[model samples]
Target: MILQALVDYYQRLLERRTEGLAPFGYSPEKISYEILLSADGGVVQVNDIRDNTGKKPQPRLMNVPQPEKRTVGIKSNFLWDKTSYVLGISATSKRADKEHAAFKSLHQEHLAGTQDAGLKALLAFLEAWTPARFAAPHFSEDMLDANLVFRLDGERTYLHERPAAQALRAQLLASQAEGQPPLAICLVTGEPLPAARLHPAIKGVSGAQSSGASIVSFNQESFASYGKSQGDNAPVSERAAFAYTAVLNHLLRRGEHNRQRLQIGDTSIVFWAEAADAQEAERAELLLADLLDDRPTDEQEAARIRSELEKVQKGRPLADIDPRLQEDTRMYVLGLAPNAARIAIRFWEVGTLGLFARRLAEHAADFHLDPRPWKTAPSAYRVVLATAPQYKDSASMDDAASQLVGELVRAVLTGRPYPRSLLANALMRMRSDGHVSGLRVAICKGILARERRLGINSDKEEIPVSLDKASTHPGYRLGRLFAVLEAVQRLALGKQINATIRDRYYGAASATPALVFPVLLRNAQNHLARLRKDKPAAAAGLEMDIREIVGGLADNFPRSLRIEDQGRFAIGYYHQQQSRFRQEDGADSGNTESTEDHIEETQA
Candidate 1:
């Protein structure tokens, strides 16, 4: 019986897309499952499903659809994982409370027994059942079973029959305002319908009827009517409502059938499609509603979908096109704004920038390789567009800045910034300087390390390794502390620069050279300026290397400063070089003056 159950379970899993296995369904012939007992007497089960099946099912993710070529902007495959739920419904206060506790305990038992599918299904059911905070209105049993009626007309649906549906629709329409799209009626039955539940009678309804109206029966496990079975109506568990409504939603949304108007008593569901005919439209509504109700909406499923999307191409550019040059075409095709903030950050486990750069470069290229060449925007423009579809070009940095914009300038830039809101969320997890500020520096630092692998160390290379809490801080800019290490770098490279006068006056200079900071003080100042700009451009579009800007700032030096403390000289040899240059220049001027004075005296 256990083997038979496992086999039956495996087959069912293949037929339907479930939590663990891929969509293409595992081949039963090849799948192998084994249970091993742990030292603690707990069982451990592993499935060589993917290996045996040759190719796992490849079901497209939910919530998001694939991007089309003509669409403009960046599309993110961002998703949250689905959460499991355990809904407990019952009559009587004590029974309901007991049922809820039982469900929780049942879930824990499923986890213990290693019945993964049942456990996951229970959790998903529970998640859907859990309303954040709903105040249940006290109702008599008669009120709960009373049938309500409604009608669907154009965009507006009316409950001409059932006072319950009627009352709900009237309240909805009023709250929605007159000019807004008519709200569709969703009949939340006061009680689960009974087994062999016949359609509610509408003896007086006539004008609000749909053509070719047919009674569609569901077993109540359908997402739209999932919890209905707990009531007296649905009995035979073998014929679950999943058989009908699930298929209906799957077929309609997947574009299988072409039916429109779906009439449920006085309530009518009108189609909301651009080209869908009546019959098809009704089916679509039913399917969409089913999806919304059945699918998990919390962070987990979203995370899962997002992870899968990242694995796939949520949005890709035309392969032949360069991302930097294809901004306009990409936006036009993708419907994204050029300056809208859409950033893709990748982290490397080894803490190297080169790995990130290499991977990003690869994925960015792969994104452009759309199979439908003629259907998309130009390859160049589509490659580097933002992830927002409604992004406008008027707020573009190129148009605003016109001449000068750099990395920091662009980072702060926005214009209905596409997906930046999402990016900001991701950025929260990023570490500022390896301590988990977020992904920004983590990604940048990784890129730097990747570049190092390629033997490319540009002149100015200061990836803030850590925040100096005790040192004289250089103030925060663009949410990060900008260290004035550019001064240290230039001083070492035969250039002279001083720390900000504030640092000098306070005598807060560290007693050692800042070995990690690779830029000069002047360059650091330039970075600060760039970050302060209102309309910054993308980092990829910056005309000059960020290091050079910092390097320039490192050149500034005060000519009147001289110090000789051999034993405890906190300043490096670079300080001595700057002093030497000032002395040399002073001596040359003095000599020239002396010669002129002698000549004048002689003439006298």
Candidate 2:
């Protein structure tokens, strides 16, 4: 189904060139060098077809025919290849001789037999060009690694662009019609065509091989069944193979202004829509990029997303919000991760644009909490990073982190319960870091809320948007009490104290409250006494807040908390901490102070 959808979209892209879709082609390759040759086979000049100003070469995509199967022997591209094949330029490598021989044989069998004047001219140039002469002064040894294309005279006519080159390509394709292996019904199109022996390589996945990797491959004899080998075992036709690969490569191609692809953890995610209207598809593409991007560049973009999300939540028609978009447009989001020599489909989602938008709004709603002075709602990326251990590099996340990201995306798209491990990881990070970040607290709340929606733990109390004075969950009250104690210490010792109560007891307090809260409460009395001498009114306010939280808990703490309740503990702490700030200022101040300073000011 994925391959067929891609092939259909490929045909659509080909048809809607100027009206809506960008012009693209199958079997096209981006080359970095264009070798301009004269009719008499003289090297006019070796042109660098890449932009040299950047650290990497910026190549141009050219419409050239490609081979269907991976070739172990030298098989020349339609009109472009390495210098060894196009100009017989041999490097010190042993494969250069074989490449030169293969190029000579191919030209003699194909181009030499053709009557096209341009191809004949190109042949004549190839015959006269030699490795030693071409490399002596004009070309370097490193130049042999770059792709080279032939140009006839000053007309700038590439061999592949000539009429005869097209004919030669058709002939080559037709030759496979007679001597090919037994035909099978193509699974993609339900047509009787030669099954592709090897599928094309899929590139642009993070950590995949530079030469690209295969999504469907069978190398071991044990893996083959019914005497089928490689791609034949799956039976995707050549046309379908080309279509899917070309479409994927086009989507994956990264340019300075490209926004269709995003790297999430270890997954490379690409999104596209199949719509009858070309303009609708383009708009859907833009919307998907905006929805998936966790950290958009500017405030204006964030506001735009928020506005769109509001419309989605309000049940506005997609066409009403953006006339270019259609609610019924079929959209696909594929997440690919590198797995050795093959690519793994980490996640695949198919749905209408409206459904996707609504689910995205639900995803945003999960992260919504009482106002945090420090930030707006967190992006998915921020929430995921909050689960990582302190000071750990999130880019090189472990298998667990990768799985969490993949599952999180799946939950957002499908409206499923979030993975249980997400809550566990967030709680772990909270314990490790000794503080709950706004993003972390948001993630915990989101996970538990979804868990309730999915009926995973329907009986559990919901974590509130902010401090709840009437709640009686022991873990929640303990967390609130712990926050009060930290505030009292901050007020008593001044803001310059090296470490607060959180720095010492957050992990134990959240997990085993009975083991730590007694000691904490005892220490809080000394802090309260000191605060009474210095700031009696502040001390009284802090005492009342602590009493209200404990009063709901019946003045008792739980011996231990389950993982879910531990999440509640973190949320309770975060809400109480935020509440203190709100009570003092009566408004959400967008403060940028460190966590310690912020906690200390909550006392003030």
Candidate 3:
């Protein structure tokens, strides 16, 4: 009964699909099978086909008559779909990590068989299976988020059959099953051999006068020398040999039984245990047709389906828009090497893609920042600016200029500097409303090389006004302006300030000439904080420090400045620091020292 049930089930599955069975061949009306023997070489027993009236016999026949006379044992094997089975492993975000945590834990569990067997088998297969890698190894959650993985053996045996075999089997089973003469049935048991399209044979007959070649076949290796002679290669010949042998073995075994004729038209199709000849050739010369259990060959449709499937399984880059940018503006920000990895961090702290686009849109007028050019490359956006052209000459254009200021603030906070080109444009713009202050001039000259790079022509056109205008410009505040200018100057001057000014302001007792001053002004601010909090910090001398400040001035003297010019600059910086300290301390010196007295002594 079980044998008949299995046959019925197989017939139903074959009939359910018609993909590769249609074009090539004739159909078989009846299938006859020889007994399948067990491992012990004895016949394996199974139930027989249902009798008429659709009722199974009460005492199932354990041994249906062996069709070919010689008693044979039963062999049984099960078939399954490739798509129905799955490997139950998943990857989750909470897993420790790739190194000592996640994969290690999983591998250990897999080795122990504690992990699900299906999933483990699938993972092992994946580690060895080269094809379809692009579709596997994606992120998933445990128990909740399940993804399909292919396993070798677990619960059910999944048969990887050729499309033609799968299709032909389905078509024959589709027609109503009647236990008539044309459709004979038999029962057998024992697992089927492992699936393979080809195998080698030990022997075959060779022929001479028959127009057909009667060649005695031998094991695959025997033909190697014959194949490699002054003819084709051994490997190719061996493959052909194996395939022919396998086909012959199947045909001879299945054709052991015979006798069935079902007439559809002038052509009389006979369904029996096996096929005697290739149907196409036999049809041309004979009266009756014999069906064989040979491979049904259809290449194109299978190839097409596989091609489409592969295309659907590939990975693609992610793209989406955020709420911040409503207008159409694209910006590209490039990071420097290691910084590129922290793109997400920058996004969260600053803004999303939309936020960048919106900022560019908002400042379109002043900076004339257009974002269209940076849509790709550098992989992430960093500091890019753009603006609309219409507001190029507006007085409030400086408002768009605030973006530059914000960038500067970020620079100070991060202790990184912007590129020279960006710094130059910012300074030239800032100088527009006022005389460039001493600090601003020094910084702009030092880092940007603005005067050197932009030249006099561009400077006059780019800088809006002099330092006087800058001090009073609405966008400029005193303290921020001073800090920004000092920072730029320190950066421009090879990160060094005059030793005397460094000691006086930053309290560096061992100030050396040419020492790169990383954060002079910042250090000064810290010193001021110490003073304010009444911290026990070493006090900075005002006069001797003033002399060293002059000495340091000589060290930073630009080539363009004459001796007289240097004298004036030294006096200016000294007085500037003094005035700054006085304000910080709120100490009033009613009578200020004469500038002439200080100058005369310095000159002497």
Highest TM-score scorer: 2
Off by over 4 Å in 3: 1-150, 153-358, 368-604
- Candidates in descending TM-score order: 2, 1, 3
Candidate 2 Cα misplacement greater than 4 A, ranges? 18-26, 52-56, 67-72, 90-92, 135-142, 313-320, 373-376, 392-400, 589-604
Q: What TM-score does candidate 1 get on C-alpha atoms?
A: 0.18
lDDT of each: 0.25, 0.74, 0.26
Residue by residue across 100-157, what tens digits does model 3's lDDT show?
2223343334334423333344334424422132141232222222212121332222
| Residues 1-604 of candidate 2: C-alpha lDDT, one tens digit per residue | 7777778877787776522222322365667787676666677777777777788776666666673344576676666776666666655546776777777777777776777766777777767766657654557765766677777766766877777787777787777655678888999999999888777787788889878898888989987999878877898887787778877877787764667788878778888888878677879988877777746678897788766766775677887778878888889888888999899888899999889988988877776666642333444555565576644223224533766777788889999987778788878877876757676777788888777777888546776766677777776777788888888998999967998889888999999988998898898899899889999999999999877877788545788898878878887887788777767766644443335433422321
Candidate 3 structure, TM-score to reference:
0.16
- Candidate 1 vs candidate 3: the lDDT winner is 3
> Using lDDT as the measure, what is the rank order of every candidate, best first?
2, 3, 1
lDDT of 1: 0.25
User: Where does candidate 1 stray beyond 4 Å?
Assistant: 1-229, 232-244, 248-274, 277-428, 432-604
Q: Give the best candidate by lDDT.
A: 2
